[model samples]
Target: MAAAAAAAASPATAPCFPSTHCTRPALISLRFSRRVKVAASTDNPSPAFNSVTAFAPATVANLGPGFDFLGCAVADASLSLGDTVTATLDPSLPPGTVAIASITSPSRPSLATRLSRDPLRNCAGVGAIAALRALGVRSHAVSIHLTKGLPLGSGLGSSAASAAAAAKAVDALFGSRLPRDELVLAGLESEKAVSGFHADNIAPAILGGFVLIRSYDPFHLIPLSSPPALRLHFVLVTPDFEAPTSKMRAALPKQVAVQQHVRNSSQAAALVAAVLQGDAGVIGSAMSSDCIVEPTRAPLIPGMAAVKAAALEAGALGCTISGAGPTAVAVIEGEEKGDEVGRRMVEAFASVGKLKATYTVAQLDRVGARVIATSNLE
Candidate 1:
């Protein structure tokens, strides 16, 4: 204790730490001895980390009224990716400069070697890696592995979640020299590659909460304040089916009816207001408030009306499409009703043949996406 106290009081006698390098903006620390430690504090500066790993959550984008502009986070859906730092010569790297060490799903088996492809594609691993390449960050090479827990293209922002997670992992692995906003931009770049257009789903996955992407001269995002009285809960139903995003986008009419457009826009504003006011009833009511595409696209998914009816009867606040469709999302006032809503949804599916569909009750996950681990420090 006396020796430690003396070392702490005496900077000259304390074990000398790295004070030469400041290439990366991120600060890191490593403990070398019982009485000596290496750190970059307010009085110390050192080289940043060289590697990292990221974990991002699946997102529900364009939730009903907020098409192409709004999104929310989910807890159950998640993805992870790992990488190698290229700025310095390090080990644990494969030959292709950057390589995918393993993949949890065989969804996109061939993408492991396609460096030019966007990492945000249907298979999350590929999309994340691709997004990194687009950032012109070849100075760092990454070996990644992605876990696909969310339903792909089932109206859940699976690609966005994967891309954001991968982007975060890459940044952290490299000592997080990139700014928070820039890291989000990099995630969006990956999403664009797979979705073929830019949206805010991936950005807020890193930032958290409900985000509104205002595509103005100076692009900005507006996050709505969430209320505590309104308990967050959801009933997600995935039918024994799939709908490709490409097809669904093509189905949307480029030009909407003038009245319908106005109504949808109004509902979007109302929904945002409802959240701030802590009005669960209004929030659920607003879920059914979509007049733009739901009416036009409802028939695409079989047993839609019956499922919705069952969800409502089971005490759900509102019932609507999860993201695109096939998967229905139902809102509950509180978690107590969660099981009931789920059962009702399942019953509804049973009426049409239980073997044809499945549903689960979930909550509105406000935590957003984030990483769970790291590899090394520069």
Candidate 2:
């Protein structure tokens, strides 16, 4: 197995956050696609065991123009608590067996307090169970734990991280039979329960790096062929407020101007090209070029303009509302710039009122999901 390095190369190109510019090709195009190339593939195998631990990264959904079709994994996401699944040694029971057990993140207790219960329903856990069920490993008892790092419903793909981690852990417990796409689908299904029927957050979280959800029929997902030499930094500012996903969706305008739509499409495509070619300048330009969602959502969040301005002034490539709103993200060059930009974003949020802002500095995660440990009761 390859030793874990500090970090892998850029997932695809030097693209600034997920931006949706163009309508995906009507037909799936696997040939000459730039989204399939990745610098790393962690596929070391292990025997089915009794317990496991998994970490899932936070993800940005509807990146700029990609709008549910595109997204990228951000490192340092929340850690879904943990789970232990193993076959119970009971001669009295039937030959085939299946059972599930869940544990809460020590940080918080009581399902009522949790935004989403049925931990198995969580994106990370759902992906894990879906993988196990697909493998046909029906005879086993499993236990799960969760670690909540990112705030749920903050548009940070918080639930996706939990689901991805749990899904990967379940795969390990069952001897890792499911393919990558299957796991991604599992997470997507879990996402449907809370955030309505559609969201691209789980796809990138499952596969890692950048993903373009080109289709749902047989799921035509492609990992972007990002430039390895590129390094994009970010400042994610999460404000202290819970903006229900349902309400946020209702705030969107159903109609848009024709010219605004055209500009958005053109700029979104430009963002993709910039990422593919590793041009920060072009990507940065695209970050502020949004004609579809941000304008309408901006008013819902306080201090949007000021916070974004601070991020830019602090050397950010571009800035925008992260995931939904309230949480804003700024794209930058590297760690130094990320730190500086993050500081500015926090300060920017203060002008609104007495609000707490969580400033996160992150990079594009290149690798998808994997199991750190696992166990199966057989």
Candidate 3:
């Protein structure tokens, strides 16, 4: 069952905080009934397992004009395009400690080697620690093993995926008592340590579907509904280039003209409305209408304009850069259309940008982070 319960709250519209601030918004209060069913009481404090494995899907943040306020989880058909984390109780380690056992990526071995093993420096470890603190469990230490399925700096929420998976795995190892909001908060803390204090990527990765982060100071999130008729497919073409989140963020304009802000705000609202109305065409159109951030960052990415144009020309509903991308994402209606649009975008990258590229076709992942396996102590 999905973690969040249906609740009503007005959407918040505060701009993102300055880069120096360490504090972030909190997720609105909502209990996870599914977790509550299995929560262990103080009298029966024994853990449900000694080890657990969890998966969190890759995510596309910003969604064009939404900036740091909107994101959605996405996965390929096999659901093999995200991060997996395994957390195990280690009695030998010091109590209340979280450590990284290994970081390996079967798909991107070189990228895996680049990640740090220090728990405080790594998202997975930090996230596990955050979850443990939230659970008030310091009886045993945790050893984390992270398998990266997505490349870092791909604008695919790589760090957020690891953090979400680790947070879920550690929480489940103790009995899955943490509410969905707390899990998201853990992911946010991890992101703040590694990326920035933004929940756009982590929230969707933890809760699934499209999430609208209404406010950062008060930490309000509204999980947008996906209409049944919205059969949207995303074609993601990632070029052989690095566009780090820090660098992409630095490329943003410090201030936007009032007219441009109004235009982009309307587009963001239209995109949200399109999702609620199940209008795929409008969703695509609204997603491609971002004028401020996109315009500022597009020039930094070679062939981005051509790639977007090519995707549209190849019958994509709309095309834009995913996250702080070198990855160009296009929205389409069907698998076949995704294939064609992906091919054209990749070709544009190679021909116009002089860079090799790869593409993945994915659907929205409604279920967020989840445990795939567990082993109990004898």
Lowest summed lDDT across 10 adjacent residues in model 2 is found at 14-23
TM-score leader:
3
What lDDT tens digits, residue by residue, belong to model 2 across residues 54-86?
667778776666555667778743433112222
Q: Clashing pairs in model 3?
A: 26-219
Q: Considering summed lDDT, which 10 consecutive residues are worst modelled in model 3?
A: 5-14
lDDT by residue for model 3 (253-309), tens: 999999999999999999999888888898899999999999988888999999999
Ranking, lDDT, top scorer first: 3, 2, 1
Instruction: Please report, as a residue range, the 10-residue window in candidate 1 with the lowest summed lDDT.
Output: 1-10
List residue ranges in candidate 1 displaced over 4 A.
1-51, 76-97, 105-139, 353-355
Report the candidate with higher TM-score, 1 versus 3: 3
Which candidate has the highest lDDT of all? 3
TM-score of 3: 0.87
Reference-based lDDT, residue 210, model 2: 72
List model 1 lDDT by residue over 1-378, tens digit each: 001100111111222111110111111121122222212123221224554556666566776888778877656432222111122213444211234344453444443333212111222333334334333343334555555455455666666676676666655554555566666665664454445445557756766667787773466777776876667677777787766655566678889888988889898888788877877777777787788777656667777778888888878777777666667888777778877788778777667634377665556666555546554563
Which sections of candidate 3 miss by over 4 Å? 1-45
Q: Residue 343 in model 2: shift from native, Å? A: 1.6
